[model samples]
Target: MKKTWKRLNLIAAACGILVMSAGQAQAMGLLQAYEAALINDPTYRAAVSENTAGKEFRNIGRSGLLPTLQYVYGSGKNRAEITQPATNFLGQPTGGFAVSNYDYTSITNSLSLRQVLFSLDATARYKQGIAQTNYSDAIFSARSKDLVIRLTTAYADVKFAEDQLDLYHAQRDALDEQRRINARMFEKGEGTKTDMLETQAKLDVAEAQVIEAQDNLLNARNAFSAIVGSEVTQLDGLRAEFTVMPAKQTSFEEWMTVATENNPEIAAAKYSLEAAELEISKAKAGHTPRLDLNAGYNRGLSDSITTRTQDQTIKSIGVQLVIPIYAGGYVNAISAQAVANRDKARADLDSTRNRIAIELRRQFNALQTSLTKISALQKSVNSSTLLVEATKQSVKGGVRINLDVLSSEQQLVAAKRDLAQAKYNYLISFLKLRVAAGTISIDDIQTVAAYFSPMS
Candidate 1:
């Protein structure tokens, strides 16, 4: 039974390995992933479908203002019974009655036309449709730009996760080598038993951290795959040497003005307000009069019982006017409701403006701060590298212990990790700032992509 269990475990492990290998056949670059997402992303596809449907609103609204024509043809059988008083031959009193029966087929055809001459309701609805269509366009534009930001964020997250895992593994390897060194020195009477125990403890902790980092990396990869609709085994990495750029706009006020003018969300909200105003107009129009031109033609064969064998044709044209007197107070109530809704829309527009301003400030400030953070971390990494080497030399000369060397190595690894984190943060902040300003585009993405080199 034990041997059978062992065989099952081995088979399961082999299957997992095979699945992983098949899941990631090639490395995906940022641009390639973005292209794949554009085609495969469900969210973006939904936006496209919504935009397509929204454009039909105009047609629907205009239908009320157009002329309508209809034709009707009907055929049926008709039967009638007639009764009359009977008279005697000499015109004397006659009480008897006579009856006659007749049967025939009747056919009729009609053509009618109605053209609306005036309708406030129809006009308001047409305007509303235009506003709604504009709103849809703005929303689609916002969503399209959001896709770029979302994709870049996911890409950055995966890269950071990979960086974390690599750093942890490096730390683990350093600890493991120190453990071996301590063991050898203790055996040769050059190191103390305490040194060996300490190195072993650090190695154990480093191994646990490595395990956690691996789990994080797996999760990040899964999230990225969900967006790109495919598993990615590798990705491009940031160049070893690159320059950090500064924000172009000098003042926060300038950014705020730009966002107000260019932000798709704000535009959508304004359109919503316009549509709401039109709704108020439409509701009030319910109390107004309507006028239309009406024309019709009719033809009949065997028209009625009295003209059973006669055929007739009639054509008429006239104008119609309709004035609303009362509708159980529905019109007034609906108009008031529309007014309230319009107020709500106004409030929503204001709220959106405030929220956007807050986000714009946060991303702008973060982008500025990241430049300084990256510069500081770069220097820290450089100094940490030198410190690690110096500590190792001191240990070889009997001036420092194994523990000192281990600490210095750990510090160096930490500095490198921090530097990598800062770089990723800077890139994300820069992109987010652009998103907040409503200026994010493919060119911005391409520029960012240029900062990375494909992993060999």
Candidate 2:
């Protein structure tokens, strides 16, 4: 008995060391995962880069309305020889032809400025740029929300996989113990071979389940690593009593109103529609007159064959007007194309609204259903726990077999696993509902993070 006690102590000490080692491994919380994704996620980074580049569109459009100034300079050496039939002032032909040769360097410089005084097309294009910028901002906002949801889901997946593996391990150990008890009883001629064989078979199946669960856990961890851009050995687990709240807005119509106003996809579609409308106006303006203010200065120095070296400077400022007449019906064709595009844009906006509404409804129902399942599963877990204990007591009373106890244990673990999955599903559905409503934010992530205790 003393040696047995000593062996048990050693086993306990080894378990303690394992627990300590596991504790030493750093735990990644939801917020930390989100931060890592923000820095490392290629999709999010691409969205950021697109947003930054999109802001330049406004400047490009505004340039058309602003004054443009340019300066040009030219210098060249010129040599010229002229020969002509000799003709005197007295109008008499000479025996030899008159020849003249000249060589000189010439320089010319000019500065010009042009400012659009009135242009409908330019104004419409500028407005379109503003709308496009707004569209990019909405797209970026949507991507940010998507990142949050993705990271949260991935984190939950890892926790679920871990829980499953742990449950499998526990079940396998319990079955192994039950199998050993049956084997000993059969050797004593008390238990039947059938009972012992049943337990052994169950133990083998449990061992197989553990292997599968381990593989699942590995895959989940690898998926999480892909998102965080690093290998993850451990993560903070959800609290045992994490609460899932119902959505703030209940009715579909109420949620739809919020989504229509706040959803990034809807906003982007609206901006796209506005931009398309402006494009139509710009195309129509192609037939309208344009006015501009122009000013220029020119200076030149050159030696002429008929005159001595001369230098000249000219400065001029005036208003220029341009009236479009006809361009082989090109203007009309473009205007028609713009009108067609505006129709397409309008259709796109409608499509976006319909898509968002469908998603919002789906997520709303999923969240509600998950919440209900979580409640039901919690009660089921409690009942299964009591049943397992009762089965164990029944075995002691010789009314139930060891296989019965093992079956109860399996049911209890299964219930617990389902409950954990339900909870995770509830949380994920809640976040997805927020995403559909275009209201997901870092605050939501922080709230979820509150449910996780750091690895200790």
Candidate 3:
């Protein structure tokens, strides 16, 4: 009896250690994962690079409008030959001819500056550059939010996979225990061979389920690792008790209004439209005159055979005008193309707005439905748990059979799985709703992270 008690005490102590160790396990939360992804996610890194390049657009365009300076220098050895009919003192060409050859060095240096006094094309291009820069900002914003959505999705998938695997393991354990119980009863002649075989069949199915769940978990972990750039041994899991609130906006119209004003995709599309409209002006400028202020200083030495052994310098400044006359109808064709592009941009902007509206509606409805769905699933889990316990008692009391208990256990597992999925769905929907409204940010990530508790 003393040995038995000692064994029981040892078992209890071992279980306590396991529980403590599990509670102390290091875990990654959504915010932690996101921070890691910021430095590691290839897609986000590419977006950052693209944004950096996009910022140069403004500078590139402004350069065309600014004054440009150029300096040129040339030095070369020149050889010249002259053949002429000799002229006598009468200043008439004689029948005899004379040939001469000479070699000299020529040097030229020039500096020039040009500033656009009036150029519609350059002005329109500068405006378009500004608009394009703004568009890039909007695109980056959209991509930034998309990263959050993607990370959250991957994290949720890992969590769901973990939960599913855990439930499957538990189910297998329960079915195995039932199988053992039936085996003992059959050996004692208290249960039939039919009952034992049935329990074994169910246990086999449970084993297969556990195997599939493990595979799913591995796939989920791989996906999560792809975003976080490393394998995470543990992740903070959803809290058993958490609240899911309906969307703050009472109506879809309000969400649409907010999306129109704040959505990054819509903003990007609007900027693109603005740039396209400016493109028309730019194309039309091809047919207009351009005016510029030009200044130059030039120096030359022996630059020509007649000017050999002489040096010259000149400084000049003047206004230059260029008027377009004709160019094989290229200007008109390009102008028409620009008009077509502007129309396409306008249509694209409208399409973006409509798409945002549709997404907002879909997410808003899903969020509201998730709230109700989560509530119902919570109750179902509770009811299923109670039913499992009741069914087990019925089996022991002979009011039900082993099969009934097995069915109840399966039901309970299904209920728990569904509850977990609904919770994840709610979180994803909430985040997506804010994303569609263009209000999602790190704070939203933190808020969502709050729902994850350390593994226990």
Candidate 4:
């Protein structure tokens, strides 16, 4: 019984520690989400691994230009038999035959070195390696930027879902109150049956909407957790008076120029094209002569026929030249393929540029439209609030029915929701436009984060 109590105490302490750890994980913000995603996002991690492996291409290409050394050793036992018609010293064949048999062991050792004296293919490959490394770097940069956008968008989605759920709850509560009032009024024989039925129907619809909103919130939270690799019970909300500003560069042409120069996709495509060109050169180099410096030292023991012990050492150094005469059109075919690949790369680059241009314009226009819509919606929210009050006063004066007040309240809530959404869209479009212009950085995220306050 004492031992059981001790074990229970240990388990209780462990549970306390876990609770404390969970409590320490504060509500996540935009920048915090970005930081977590850097370590946790699978797509970004894959890019990091790929970039690390790609760095080896340089060393692989350089190996052809460096000297290589090798040591070789061999041991074997051999048996030989010889038969010959004997010849006399006077150069006349004797009428006799001789036969001999011998068994012997032999050992040999050698050290060899070779260095490329000249090779066009090796040079081209070295250049290609440099280009490939550049391409990898550009691709990693693109992925990093993509991660930032993805995290930010996901964070916004969670916020939007939460807001929608809150709005739905408020709407449901208002309808429930109205339904209760209608029920009491009908019991007193002061309200029509049709009016009570309509109120109950609206209440039921509101309840269904609340459930739908809850499910949406749950899904959004799940997506958020998937990116940050942790459950998020709460997140910071946008400040009440968050401001949206126009992009610094208003001219589309200027933004286009910047995108062309700085976009990682474009840079990667350019590097790929360079590598393809180098591949063509590498293939064409197949027809060129290759020169290599070779040197070796060798030692051998034993004579095969005499079974006599012998030792010899040989040392030699020379240059080897290989001129490719023919290869059944393989070289030409490969060269043609490389040229075609280069053309494809060029086309891809053009396509990427055009796509970026379209994206920039689209995001830019969306941002401009959001700014206008936000301004207009702000006024609409204010006007709707006044209308709700006026309708309530009219109901007190017996000039309007309860339904009119309820309709005004619904309009106010819808207007507020729309305004909130417009603000989020504006911020997102601002970030996306910068991304399209290749100017988005951590500063942008920080700026956006400044507009949010931690949940209380």
Find the candidate with the highest lDDT and give its number.
Answer: 3
Candidate 1 lDDT, tens digit per residue, 1-456?
Answer: 224324433553554344344555467777677666665578977997998899878887888889999999999998899897876889764898878899999999999999999999999998899899989888887887788778888888888888788778778877887888888889899999999889899889989999999999989888888877778878888888968775678789999998998888999999999999999999999999999999999999987888789999999999999999999999999999999999999999999999999999998888788888888999998999899889989989999877677677777877877887888777787777777788776667777888788986
Residues 1-456 of candidate 4: C-alpha lDDT, one tens digit per residue? 224324433553554334334633447777667666665678877998998988878888888889999999998888888888878999678988878887888888999999999999999999999899989888887877788778878888888888788788778877887888888888999998898889789889999999999999989988877877677878988787867665578888988988988888888989999999999999999999999999999988873444348887889999999999999999999999999999999999899888999999999889889988999999999999999999999999999877677778878878888888888888888888887887777668778888888877
Tens digit per residue, CA lDDT, model 2, 205-230: 98999999999989988888777676
lDDT of 1 at 356: 90
| Model 1 pairs whose backbones collide | none
What lDDT does each candidate get? 0.83, 0.82, 0.84, 0.83
| Per-candidate count of clashing residue pairs (backbone under 3 Å) | 0, 0, 0, 0
Q: Which ten residues in a row have the lowest lDDT in candidate 1?
A: 1-10
Of 1 and 3, which scores higher on lDDT? 3
Give Cα distance to truth, residue 80, candidate 2, Å: 2.6
What RMSD does each model have against the real structure? 10.3, 10.5, 10.8, 8.9
Q: For residues 1-456, what per-residue lDDT tens digits would candidate 3 score against the true structure?
A: 224324433553554333333433335778777766666688987998999999888998899899999999999999999999999999898889989999999999999999999999999999999999999988988987898889999998888888788788777877887888888888899999999889889889989998999999889887877776767778898888888554567888888887888899999999999999999999999999999999999999998999889999999999999999999999999899999999999999999988888888998888788778888988998999899899989888999977677667777877888888888887888888888998776657778899998887
Give candidate 3 regions above 4 Å deviation. Answer: 1-26, 87-94, 178-205, 245-248, 387-410
Better of 2 and 3 by TM-score: 3
TM-score list, all predictions: 0.83, 0.85, 0.86, 0.84
Which candidate tops TM-score?
3
- Candidate 4 ranges with C-alpha deviation above 4 Å: 1-26, 75-106, 190-197, 301-308, 385-409
On lDDT, the stronger of 2 and 3 is: 3
